[model samples]
Target: MMQQHGQHGQRDGVDAAELAAELAAELPADPVVPRVEAASVAVNLLWCVPGDVGGSEEYLVRQLLGLGEQASDFVPTLYVVKSFIETHPALAKLYPIEVANLTGVDRRRRVVAEHTWLRRRTQHAELVHHGGGTTPAVGTRPIVLTIHDLQYLTHPGYHSKLKLQYLRRTMPRSVHRASVIATPTDWVRRTVIEEFDVAPDRVVVVPHGVEADIGVEAPSEFELRSVYGLGSGRVIVFPAITHPHKGHEFLLDVMAQHWDDPDLRLVLLGGKGLADQRVAAKIAELHLERRVIRPGRVPSSHRDGLLQLAHAMVFPSEYEGFGAPVVEAMSLDTPVIAADQPAVSEVIGDAGLVLPRDPEAWADALDIVADQRVELIAAGRRRVTEFTAAKSGAALAEAYRLALS
Candidate 1:
């Protein structure tokens, strides 16, 4: 475990003062105060709005945490908005966090600040890592951009006109500017290279890593019952937001038509999205209002508790860069039954039931999930071992080296 000190401190056993001096020696003389010294990597997190970008937010945080814990040639310092510190207090303790003075919630303001303010802060860094899909028009040179997905291109209708236009304009520029492109899965990596006409060598796949914090306490049974009303029956969790491509309506139909058990309850545990009304209408139309629980974004501990208590996790999303929830469920010993989407199937890798998006097939998978619980859970545990934080950190370090080379 990385030792923590109040606010700013040594990380991964590296002395803060000594590390700073080493970085200073490597960089050219700069007039900026605190004497600007480049960390090996400066992570640009100005685009991340808390709770807004879905799993990608958690994915980035976990990767940073992993990098801190593992041995690496490059060091990372997070340049974030104040809200990021508020959202993830643990990171403040573990990393050398440089909080920007802007509120990241305003997209226009964020974009402006990224180009004008962030450029100065990152001037000395060897490379700037853009965690968000779109990079700023002006950022430090030698960029390593992480494009979570080409969802905006694939599902244009899902995004707003302004966001679509912005992404359409910026994505190409960002890709062309990036020294190396990093994607969470090969599915997304291949799509990026093909769509942008970039060389395969320019893109690298750094899969999402799962490292459960055993020390972090999960909510108790009483808390689950009192808070979410989840103790009446067997719980199947689908933790995706109510987006159209998430296949909530399809899952609802399967539950209404095929799964006849009154005791089986499906918990929808994310914030509302574009498909909220349709999902509500479907629940009402199928008279499943009583069977489906929509808690609509709970605390992380509560989410952990729900997943731990769930009989299984069912990820019916039609698309994903990487089905993190599937890996998360496995890490928590919960069996998984996910849609056979390319990225999801690649992540699952025969560990759990990866079925087609047909109602009957999902129904059959859910039926067998219980009977094969022991074996499935064991396989899931084994599968999860492949995507550890240490391994992810190593891959990221290699990517950083490639960016410099």
Candidate 2:
């Protein structure tokens, strides 16, 4: 019985020994390790402006919308003020938004609120894009600022004393603080580098894109007459706010010279600006009430209709970051007679007539454009293809990638 028990114990020991050997062979040589993954980076866009703010504001909004449609390596979050969000409810659904309930009562308060918000809420962001032409003076996040133009500095007379002072005090610091700056044209890019004393490589020139579906459809003469109180005349559309630098007075002068032409009419389409009363006074002094029409801020469809039916688009702005109307007109195959500013010249290329701001030169160019309408229209239509949203979006995406790297 003792011998039998010893044999059974020995068999049990052999089985245990085999099980231990199998476990040792199946086990890894080193301790088990965990797989680590990189956290995704996020980009924050700052666009805070009232709904009524004009072209530059509109440009920024469109840019944000286009960016949202694009596929980026990093996630994007738009930080909009409460008022803007309230006005644009669709914005909340369109992008990931972090609303800043700011009271933009005055410039000082607005600036303070923006700075505070940036400091507190932007820690998680790898980069911040300031779409409103200004950046927080104090922030650690890498910033990409879009300075539309140095017009406040260049044409100080066009801006209020308070606004001019504010820009002078803030613009330089903002430019310096930015990791990269974006401008709408090469002219603006060069100007920013020279004026702000920024490095050339730090600035990128991103031209504004033309809407893909912007085309001309003629409005019925009767409908135009009924709605805007206009007769069947050769319509010249001037799409600009009544700013002093917009050269409205110069256009008015040209119109005055041709006021006696019964078949001619001038249509002005935009919101009133600071110099609106001045323009009204000039219109009264020139006795152009009968010849001029002010359809303030028409809808996009109506504006397109005006452009479609107009004989020409007269844009005589003395300064521009980018000539949006010029491109819009070009895209619609409408002949453009623009001022010979650097940005305007670059945008017009060989498509439209770029003339001096002098009324006589503009008049002659207008006549020339009327004579060469077909050729000019063809040229403009071809040139507009260079400024599509796809092209601009791709450029901006690359710029963002560069900023991140």
Candidate 3:
């Protein structure tokens, strides 16, 4: 009996050792799973905007920074131009950064650098994400291109001939080369796929995100009136670059009608663009010099304050990839009077007044917005929750995964 017990104990010990050895062998075979958990996939982000300060540049900076803050599965190496680094000095402390000494204004040099220098530098990257409109013409790595809009093709009058030609030639090729195309709105997604003949599955719509709590102390009324010459009146802010497509002329026309009213002021925020000469001419034609205040490119910190101080925000653009101002104004609980376009309508969604492109209609809507301020503010605050960084970041991460797959 004692001998039988000993034999049983020996059998149990052998069986336990065999089970442990089998488990150890399985672990080595699946070493990738453990390493994947330890490290993230490295992606190259091409953020080469040098001179631009428009919504596209803002979107790229905010979204990339947001992704860098949130993404654990993928590590992004931001490749920026020297000017970008100069503009945003704090970026160095946040993420892995590389700078290319390229000028934003020199198209020829930019193209050469992209094809030769930028292309060669990104060889080891798992993928290249082009936040600026164009991608490297020659590259083996898969690309994810963000095309804000096809304004050059849609409204040729809005762009210079050279710019129009450059975009016409390069945009379609970029679309073809991209593994995935990311747009800010569904309207843009459909337009790009249809115009470029790209597969629908290759497109992803990631809307812009607004700050959850944008609380900026506004400059006192005295400061605004004394410094910027924003007169004592019911203020309507139009925050957009003075591009022809932005329909500043229409807003100026409306301002012309309101010129006689001493209590109405129109604050035009943003720097001048190619069509700014035309806009300046129209402002002169209307003799709205005093009634319209052109405080070109207010610092971003003051934007929310400006919006909060406004009685209403007007977006008169005829074309847009996304109406960022509309969302921004809404986030600040400011009433919006926007053009009745697809992108604007989609973003506003009955939260604010959407009127026809007619100046008379917009003028009338602005009047209504002033009266219904309380209701509009509440609606706008609620509407802005739909657009948040968490939502956009998740969609962007999924787009990267799709591109990699």
Candidate 4:
């Protein structure tokens, strides 16, 4: 818990200022900031948009902290440079480096990232070299970016045009300005190299870590199923946000082909997106209403319950930087059936069943899974153990060291 201090002289155990000071005092050490003469290795995670965590962007923040903590252990003061440091004065102390003036620079950055001068406007270079001095740059120190995916640049329709335009401009600039570039998957690394035209050597591939916020005591399988109005039967789970690129339509098509079996059920856990209305209409049109369930946006905690309830997790998507749900389900001893997409395949490897991206493949897959539930669940849990946080964080730390050295 944090203590707060207001200007009115009121002091509370949770005052924001006390919280900031506490953060400043309680961090692990590193030497990266100290080794660089007069310089600070500040990381730029300002764009870690909300809702990115616990789903796909989990690794980005954790690795930043993990790498930053490691760097601080050797470097000295490693402030977690942010624009909103004032909002949580307690968190401001988290940044041993320095916060940059992140205001109004979006337009300026857009120009540089897109037009491509690769100019010597390397003001951030000195900031890194000067211990962040009195004032931060237009961005934070070390200027590192965790490129989760290049969906906007590659597949524009996945998001809005404005966001795509923003990514179109800011990403290249961020890439160019970034002293270090990290990605969650090898496919994303390659994509960055090809799309941003960066040297393949500069982009670092660090696989994403799973949610470590689970208990050692596995929950009751029977109770878990009952929570979702399900019974001890074969379950194929697809936990994805409802989006077109997510291949929800294809997943539904797959389910429709096999919705008749009393032994099987397709449970979808995601929020309604642009395609939800149509997907619902299609369900009604196809008359398969009772066969599937869309309970919407299951929290990470509740997700554990879902996995315990599920016999198998099916990742039906067109692409991703990393399929978080697949690994998450695996961690809970849930077997997986991830589509053979590049990112998905890279993460799941041989741990789970890899099916082709064909729309109708679920029928055959479900039929096989119906009979082999126990073995599938066991194998899935075994696979998830490979993606432990220590392993993932260590790999990320190595990438940070390589970037700095």
Candidate 2's residue-wise lDDT over 294-352, tens digit each? 98888777888788777899998898888789988888778999889999899889998
Least accurate 10 contiguous residues by lDDT in model 2: 1-10
Q: Residues 1-405, candidate 1: write the lDDT tens digits.
A: 000001121131232234344443433343464524536688988766677778888778888877778766566788887888999987788777887766666554455556556677787788999988767666687989887888777777776555556566667988999999999899999999999999999999877887658315787867786787665788889998888889999999999988868988899989887799999999999999778999999887788788888888999888788878888888888899988999999999978998999998876776698899999999998999978776777678778889999
Candidate 4 structure, TM-score to reference: 0.70
The superposed Cα distance between candidate 1 and the true structure at residue 121, in angstroms, equals: 1.1
Error of 1 at 113 (Å): 0.4
Poorest stretch of ten by lDDT in candidate 1:
1-10
Candidate order by decreasing TM-score: 1, 3, 2, 4
User: Candidate 4 on 87-108: residue-level lDDT in tens?
Assistant: 3343344444443333212323
Once model 2 is optimally superposed onto the true structure by TM-score, how far is the C-alpha of residue 137 displaced, in angstroms? 1.6
Instruction: State each model's CA lDDT, in order.
Output: 0.78, 0.69, 0.69, 0.56
Error of 1 at 261 (Å): 1.0
Between candidates 1 and 2, the lDDT winner: 1
Q: For each candidate, C-alpha RMSD in Å?
A: 8.9, 21.3, 18.1, 10.9
| Regions of model 4 farther than 4 Å from truth | 1-45, 52-54, 64-137, 211-219, 370-382
Error of 1 at 128 (Å): 0.5
- Model 1 TM-score is 0.89
Q: Of the candidates shown, which would achieve the greatest TM-score relative to the real structure?
A: 1
- In order of appearance, the predictions have TM-scores of 0.89, 0.84, 0.85, 0.70
For model 4, the local distance difference test gives: 0.56
Q: Superposing every Cα of model 3 onto the true structure, what RMSD results?
A: 18.1
